[model samples]
Structures are given as structure tokens and as C-alpha cells.
Target: MTFPTIPPMHRDLDFNGPLSDERAARLIHSLGPLKGHHVVDLGCGWAELLLRTLATEPEATGFGIDLGEENIRHGRAGAEARGLADQVELEVGDAGAWKGEASDVVFNVGATHVWGGDPVVHTENALTALADLTRPGGRVLFGECFWKRPPTAEEITAMAVIPRDQYRPMPDLVDFALSHGFRLYSLSEATVDEWDTFENGNAWGLEDWIRDNPDSPDFDEVVRLTDAHRRLRLYGRDVLGFAYLTLLRV
Candidate 1:
């Protein structure tokens, strides 16, 4: 017997991070006008923000690359539905290996792992990559996770595979961006409300799926996965923080 596999939890979210429509709008607004400019989104899951930017500036062209083919497919459909098919390109590729021309605006939200290896090391490497990827005085909207406060050992255990020292504090993160030759234009952290919404959305989506496919063979595994993720989020919701940095390559 053949049973369909369960989809990833992120499939339910509009953006793959703790971002709301208002926050996204603010981030886009900070990029200023984008008419006739080139924008690139690395590790952009479905490129929701990228598509919205192009819709606002119809003359701008954009490209998004992600490792997930399903995400790329969704992005392509979104672009078509939004009447941006002619101005946007979505591809399933390695973000770290991208060698395209420097972009006028760059987005690297919650995807710094594209650089690979140690989380701390890769963070700096990702910043360096974005520096080279963006033209001088160009904007790079970088979103990353940071430690709100030191987590207890139990809290770290609840996080499963994530390392205790995987992320730096918010101030250190800003310092890293500054050290990378990026002038910070705006800095904001995801609010508790946004975090709750993001965490609940993922669990709700999985629960909905379970209800829709009660008899599926993968049900048990999906339930376990959902529980684990929910537990982890609940434990680390306060200790972990996500920062959105609007930076300009200097």
C-alpha cells in the first residue's frame, strides 16, 4: 500500500518566519523605491516578500532561490497569481553558491545556514556573502535568530538538536553586521505576539492535517513531529529571539 508523505510544517505559513503583514510592509518600505532595481532573495521560502516588493514596484525585477523545490513551485504560482510572472524568477538552487550579479536590494531572512558549517561561523560568512552580493549603498534585509537571554540546560535539552551557543545576543548580532561593513538602517525584534502566532500556526496546521488524514500511515510520525516542535517552541519562545536588520552595504 502507498500512502502520501506529510508536508513540512512551514507549508502552512505565509512567510517562513515570525513575520506579520505589518512587519513585512515596514521592512519593504525601508528598502525605499525599487523602480528598475535588481532584488535578490537568498533562501527565500516561496518569496512572499519578494513578490510583494515587485507588486509595489512593477518596474523592478527580482530573483529568489531556495533549496526546497516545493517552495520554489509555490513562489512561481504566487508570482503568476499576483501578475508578476514577467518580473520575478524563482529557482530551486543553492543560495550560498549563487554567483549572479550584485543586487540593489538583498534579502537573507532566517536562512543564514546556507553558508553551511558552524552556526556562529556561518553567520559571519553569510554577512560577508551578502556584502559582496549587494552593490555599494544597496540594502540587505537580514533576519536571524539571537539569544534573548542565556537558556538553562533543560531549556537547551528541549530544543533537541540545536546547540546552546548557536546564536549570539542581539547586541552582538548588530555588532557583527557593523563589522561586516553594513550600516544598520533599522533594527527590530519579533514581538511576543508574533512569536505566539508563528508557533501556534505551525501546530494548528499539523493538527488540521491530522484531522484531514486520520487514517494515513504517516499520522503517528507527523503527530510526534508536531509535538516535539510545539514543545521546543514553548520552551524557547522567550529565550530565543529573531532580529530583523535593515542594513546598507557601505
Candidate 2:
């Protein structure tokens, strides 16, 4: 079946994840002094946080790489709008293979697949990459999904057909990071309200489109897909959790 072309996620979302402005501010503040430091964001969709970091630290330069051309363009536009175009490089490239000077701050939020691994090993692979990319004493902001609680069989099936084994518990997530040669600095989980906003933002574009284009060819299919997505998200919202870990490279 042909799917409707919906609005882009960046238009509605800021960080492309369940991140609130308050939490984002705290995370940026936790990075300490970034003066004269280089920051890198891998698989950065629109690089909103990266731009924010650069905006906060005028002396810091940033490099953001993502595979999505549209996202890169959006990021570049944001940089220009924020008067940060000269200090940051927002480009479309293979983040996993891109190498550069070790950075003082590295971000791999919600994009572990950039490092190439199976679901079970994705976090580990991303940690390894982050360790290599970050200088000693640098901070890495890692965001990923974890199981808030064990899901029932029906709930698991409703969660986009994803298997329960795809994510570990929160404790295991911390242990996994520590095992990869890092010291945990701070950890926080996305609140239910944040999750609700993110999920709703994900669908609002399509919902608006469906409402405005009732006579369009893809209107019915768009509505159907959006409804299915809402149902699945509701089922998984309580069971799935997203964690943000700030780790110092050892």
C-alpha cells in the first residue's frame, strides 16, 4: 500500500525524541565549561541540541553528521537562523565512518544504529564509538530506549511488532555503559508527559494533513495509519522508557 507523504518530524519536534526544554537545559549545563571545546553529534536529526550547545558556548565549534539530507538542511537552516552557521558544520554523511578530532562533548542520542549492531548489541557498539570519539574527561550524552517494565505478550505485539528482548531494564543500561569504560555522571528518564508530547508531535503533522486534505487520494490511508500508530503508542507508552545518560570518558 502506498503511504501518504506527511509533514517532516523536525517541523513539529525539537530534539526528535522525548526531550523537554528544561531537561535539555540541564543536560547542556551539566557539560561544564565547553569554551574552546569541540562538540560532535552523530546521526543528528536537525541537530537542535547541538545548535543549542553552540549557542550557549560561543567559543565552542560543532560538527553534526546525519544520513538524512532533509535533516541536514534543516539543521543548517537552524544554525543560520541562530547565527551559528560559521561555528557549526551540519552535513549529511555516514556518521559511523566519519572520523574527526576527538571532541570534548559527543552526542549519540536515539541513533545507536549509526554504529551498526543488532538490537541486543546496539548500545554497546554506540558506546564503543563514543569512547573513541570523546577525549578523556569529555562528556557523552547518550539517549536510548529501555524496558520500563516487562511487557505482556499482547503488549509486545502491539509495540510495533518489536520483540521484548530488544531492550534491557534501566539498571542493565547503566551497567552496560559502565562496562564500556565510562563513569556515569547523571541519568534521567523521560517522564510520561514528555513521552506523550513527543508521540503526539509525531502524529500531529499527519493528523493536520488528513484534516486539511479530506478529498486527497491518500487521506483515508493517512487517517488509518495515524489511528493505528496512536493505538500502538498508547500500548507501549507505559512499558517503554527512554533514558538519557551523561557519562564521562575514562
Candidate 3:
């Protein structure tokens, strides 16, 4: 099945945007041997994290897959700009249906949530699909939504982007990984610094877009979500959080 494509213009196109590379690096490094190894980044987007990996590990080669043609083109162009074109590549395809040789790591950041709102199904599909691409002892880097302390009423409303009952806690997902032949290697919560930064950066000018242009369901949803996010920032700081997980294939 063909997945919908999200262009760079319509999508968030910033590196680390609000995430700190200095912080995420330690988590990334824990999945070592990336150098001189092939790695596939699922839902690659603009390839910011992949670019960072390419820069850090001189011997590493990268394959970045996304549903968007523009993201692929832009990513390829970025690789060229970095003088790492030969070591980096891109493809447009659905992550669940994609099949290939096992790469060193099947990685994603802020992508697990973009699977059309069904995280359980989406995660299973990813696991089944990615299993084909992961050699024994390989790993998958998942950076996704997580509960901090407890969900507040406002946080529940904001997270209504997905069903409240369907909400899967971070540890729950880690359990899912362990059950499906993937072992949890590391887990870390997103601190206030990263969460606040990402939320604020992504929320910039969102209200203006909604007010100025009333006809965009595409952009309107983005604006609505951003508005709710701003509410959380103003009201529910301690109750909301995002975390990154690293899972190793058994």
C-alpha cells in the first residue's frame, strides 16, 4: 500500500529542531558499530538525524526511507552538500511494506507517532517489516511519545490525536518490544529542557496560520494541535513528556 507523502513545506523541517544532539548522542552511541556499517532510517523525513550520524561516523553508510518525494530529494541534496552523497541514499516507500537486507540499525526519531494514529498496529507493522531488515543482534532506535508522571485532563485532550484508551505507556511499548523478540537496551525520558524546546519551536506561528487561513484542514489540524500544545506548555508542563528508546533484535 502506498502511504501519503508529506512534503518538507508541509512538514516540520528542522534539525534536532528542539531536540538536543548533545543529549541524544549518548543514547545513539550505545548502539555502536555504526561506522562502516549500513543503517536504514525509517520514516527518514528531512534526514537530520541520519545526517548527524553520517557526520559522526565516517565509515557509516545510510539509507533513509520516507513517504515523501520532496523529503527524499532534499535529503539527497543535503548528503551531496555534506560531501557524503556516496555514503548516503534515500527511497520513498511505506515503512511497513518495505523489505530489504538487514541494515545495522532500523532507526527513527519522532516518527512512530506519524503512522496515521494507530500506534499499536503501526508498531507491530514496523516490527514485522523491520524484522526483515535487522540481522541477529541488530537494533531499532525509536524516539516517540511517553508519559512523564501522569496525564492531566488537558494532556488527555491534546493527546486525543490518538484515542485515550489506545494510549500506550512508554514502558508498555518497551514490553511490547521485549515480547516480540526485541530486547530493551536502554530507556530515557525527555527532560523539561528538550520537551519545552521542541514544543515551543514547533508551535511557533501556528496560531497565526489558523487565523489567517481558515480553509486548510491540512494546515488547520497542524494549527489546532499546535494550539493545544501551547496550552500544555502554559498549563501542563510536569504532566507531559517525550522519550527515546533503543531496542535490540533478538
lDDT of each: 0.88, 0.89, 0.68
* Pairs with steric clashes in candidate 3: 36-59, 102-133
Candidate 2 residue-wise lDDT, 1-250, digit = tens: 6666678988788979999999999999878899999999999999999999999989999999999888999999899998999999988999989888788999999999887867767777898888888999999999999998999888977766566777889999999888888999999999999998898889888888987899998777778778888877989888899999999999
Over 4 Å off, model 2: 1-4, 212-225
Q: After superposition, how far is residue 107 of candidate 3 from its true place, in Å?
A: 0.4
TM-score of each: 0.92, 0.92, 0.78
Clashes of 2: 0
Model 1 clash pairs? Answer: none
Q: The CA-based lDDT of model 1 is what? A: 0.88
lDDT of 3 by residue, 1-250 (tens): 2222232342443553346767657766867777678888888886878877777788988888888677788888888889888888888887555667887788876666434536646666555566667888888877765555567676667655543444357777677667777788887777787766666555544655556667755665665566666665665576545666788888
**Which residue runs of candidate 3 sit more than 4 Å off their true CA positions?**
1-13, 16-18, 113-117, 150-154, 205-236
Worst 10 residues of 2 by lDDT: 157-166
Residue 217 local lDDT, model 2: 81
Q: Give residue 27's lDDT in candidate 3 (0 to 100).
A: 68
lDDT for each residue of candidate 1 in 1-250, tens digit (9 for 90 to 100): 3334446545667877899989999999999889999999999988999998888998999999999887888889988998999999899999999999898999999999998988657788899999999999999999999999988899999988678767889999899888998999998889998888777766776788888998887888877877888878988887999999999899
